[model samples]
Target: MIESPGLLLTLLAFVLVIGPLVFVHEMGHYLAARWFGVKADAFSIGFGREIAGWTDRRGTRWKLGWMPLGGYVRFAGDMNAVSQPSAEWLALPEEERNQTFQAKPVWQRAIIVAAGPVVNFLLAMLILGGFAMAYGDTRTPPVVGTVLENSAAARAGLQPGDRIVRLGDRDIHVFEDMLSYTRIHPAEKTTVAFERNGQVQTLPVTIGVDQQTDRFGNNYRIGMLGIARGDRVTVPVSLFEAPVVAVRRTGEIVSMMVETIGQIITGRRSVKELGGPLSIAKVSGEQITLGADAFVFLIALVSINLGFINLLPVPMLDGGHLLFYAIEAVRRKPVGPEVQEWAFRGGLAAILGLMLLVTFNDLGNFGLWQSLASLIG
Candidate 1:
């Protein structure tokens, strides 16, 4: 575990960020269950030995656990924290069964299972909406005010007053779009369509690559066109419109995530890019150091990511449960319990394998393994 002051701060930041996110996710399940008259046995913020806890008046044990990485809620009929049904639930009296989660309608069960991810998405929307309402969009238009000499823009015959209309197939809406799109394609040939005076013109340009370093000493290569913003515009959205903007932004992030996953699965990208708890801690610490707005924005981003990850069709996840429920709905009966048990077991194994892989990647990211190897050498 990280023990240095900076690393400790990172650890604290991870908890501060992850704690609320996990709470919100499980809270979604808890609230939905309560709404449907299902009794919750416990609501926990972590796993293993309890650090602190108290039973609520409703007999729900609210507790914090030693492991601060993840959490769950135990319903009345649950065999364990994963919400598997217990045999006792099956043999319970009608009154007791009525209060159990499995006793509810399958639709209700699906809702309860799905509510965690839904709440995560909603939490992200709320945070993003809050940001939009507070700061508004301060971005500028994608018009070239000046083209640097000997840069990609100048070489492409780009001149002052040219308004960029498109980059390849993507329609340019603002200067941020141009910068964001180009920044990833260093040293690559790209087609730029712009409006010069009254006519639209297209140009073939090779993006310039620029290497830069962050405060963390990590280096990155970014594409550069060397064009400055022509005019700035701040569009302040109404509270009503903020959520819509937030949703659109969330959609963008989700789309990018999906694309990245597809790339990874298709071998276009490496699985080494996948991050675990250490990456989150590092990024969370960096964001916290930036300021409240940046940290909250990071929270929104991570929350959305959490929601999306849980929606995957892998067993032992919220999405896996939903998938089973969908199959049950179509079949008009639940999958056999033995099949579920095996499936969940397999799911658990898959999850553990993935966790280990990502943790190894995290260790590599922190240079721990490299340090150990060098020490041994």
Candidate 2:
């Protein structure tokens, strides 16, 4: 059972983590709309009834919502928070129509829709770059300093002083690269290449799986190579190079996310590993306990994920709007309102279904279902 302090921390951490992200995301849209001279009717941090907020000089109804799940920017002449074009708003007089979102050219509308996710990516890059500049980067060579006795590396003929060159098809540049590759391929047979005394050799090794339980009793299964790294080097990155490092790191993270999703699609990974708001809250709390650095790192990771998820071509998402704009560009006319309405409905259903699945997974992870079963029994 969670203690009172821990529970409170989790709640606070969740708000701290999610609130800023939501605000940043919506602000991106609002800013882009304003740049195109589109009037904003409302700017909310969350959904549902307003908790507290004040209007800006531009007459935007900037308000806080009671439900803190997500947020939206309702542009003037929008039918709803999703920014669907209102028939009456579209039929406004020429002078007034100029300030509505739908009155803008297709390119402008697309930019406004795309800005939210782009800002999310930018936010992540900025945070990561700041860390790189402040703490420097770790540059540990992927040389095996020790091979654990009777472990997979030992059985595979790996020895001390072997400089790991590649794992399967992935080239191991640093120790962290090797670790990243191994962590995702637990219990799978993989090819390892290393150099010893100027001679390169390859061997097949089945990665060992290690099941670990965290302080919160959450279990994780990770792959282990049973080989340790040598000394590490920390290099200070220059201001000009920090952005390059941040972009590279962000790309690597996106690649990992893509690979994980591909694994799930191929049935190589379990869908039960999928998480929702509860899992995020738990993780946020745990990271807060670790330190501000750890918690901030979590924010960057989640920001990238939010950006990537929004880019998926699902209806009702930013990507979905872009997809519609793409179709409109090709046809030289907007998609039929009936078609858009149906597509959005379908999208909403898919999103709701996914939420239910993830929530169920979160409950199981928290042992809620198991505890209820035990109580009934």
- C-alpha TM-score for every candidate: 0.89, 0.94
Local accuracy by lDDT, each model: 0.87, 0.89
Pairs that collide in candidate 1 are: none
Candidate 1: segments with Cα more than 4 A from true spot: 1-5, 80-87, 148-160, 184-191, 197-209, 221-226
* Model 2 CA lDDT for position 198: 100
1-377 per-residue lDDT for model 2 (tens digits): 43222888999999999999988988899999999999998999989999999998989999999988889998878865445567777678878778988889899999998999889999999999999999998889999989998788999999999999999888999988999988888888989999999999999999988898776667899888999888887899989999998998999899889988988889989999999999999999988988899999999998898889998998899999999999999999888888888888999999999999999999998889999999999
Q: What is candidate 1's local distance difference test score?
A: 0.87
Weakest lDDT window of 10 consecutive positions for candidate 1: 1-10
- lDDT for each residue of candidate 1 in 122-200, tens digit (9 for 90 to 100): 9999988888888896568889999999999999999999999998666888898888767756677879999998899
TM-score of 1: 0.89
Candidate 2 has a TM-score of: 0.94
